[model samples]
Target: MNMATNTPLTDEQSTEAAIQRAGKTAPRVTLMDIEAVVTSEFYFTASDGVFGASNYRPISDRSGVALGLLTFCVLVLRNGFTVTGESACASPENFDAQIGCDIARKNAREKVWALEGYLLKQRLHVVE
Candidate 1:
């Protein structure tokens, strides 16, 4: 009778082995851990779009381009997963380009925070 040949590895063991193969020491990670590794940033314009529009690129005085309404996008990526946040912002009465960029980036981060919260809840539910 060969127990090793007859027995199958448990789910936890399998998962841990996979993680080890991936070079990660831990088999499981909490939501906070995911959030810590998760990153979010804004892009001011897109390459193939208008001359100077979108979040991946913005028109500026340096380029002799008139400053106009700017659209920005927040891209969040983690462990092969991606999420996006988008915003259109303008230089207001007192706000400058830097300020507008800050606001846009903040908005995107909020979106990512909400998504992370939802994911955390789902993971917690499954564990219980």
Candidate 2:
């Protein structure tokens, strides 16, 4: 009589195989990179909108825009927004400070779509 048997690989061996496979493949762009691009574009847009057509007190507008950008960045970063990326809208805490929760939610939804479009046009893919 002949019997077929299966043997399981050790964890160390499986890990080593995964590492080797990873090393041989081209580095893939991650969702984090897409998030960074979105963040940059958001700030750039805000800055340009504030200063692009201003002649009087351009400095004041620039300063206000900068402060707003920094506040947004700090809020997002400190609150673990990057980990959720475009899904931050689903969290109530994200808009807890806003005067109108409904408006905040709507804006967040729009932002996700806009950011996704920007990333797609830039040839960036979000890793699942």
Best by TM-score: 1
Structural similarity to truth (TM-score) of each candidate: 0.47, 0.22
In candidate 1, clashing pairs total 10
Model 1 regions more than 4 Å off: 1-35, 38-40, 45-49, 52-67, 80-95
| Model 1 TM-score, all chains together | 0.47
> Which candidate number would show the highest lDDT if scored against the true structure?
1
Candidate 2: tens digits of C-alpha lDDT, residues 37-65: 44322222233444555633333564653
In order, the Cα lDDT scores of the candidates are: 0.54, 0.39
Candidate 1 achieves a global lDDT of 0.54
lDDT of 1 by residue, 1-128 (tens): 22678778644357556777889853344334545755765565332245445434444553323233444655566654555444444433553556556656656656666766687688878988
Give each prediction's root-mean-square deviation over alpha carbons: 14.9, 16.1
* Colliding residue pairs in candidate 2: none
State the TM-score for model 2.
0.22
Model 1 CA lDDT for position 63: 30
Residue 102 lDDT, candidate 1, scale 0-100: 61
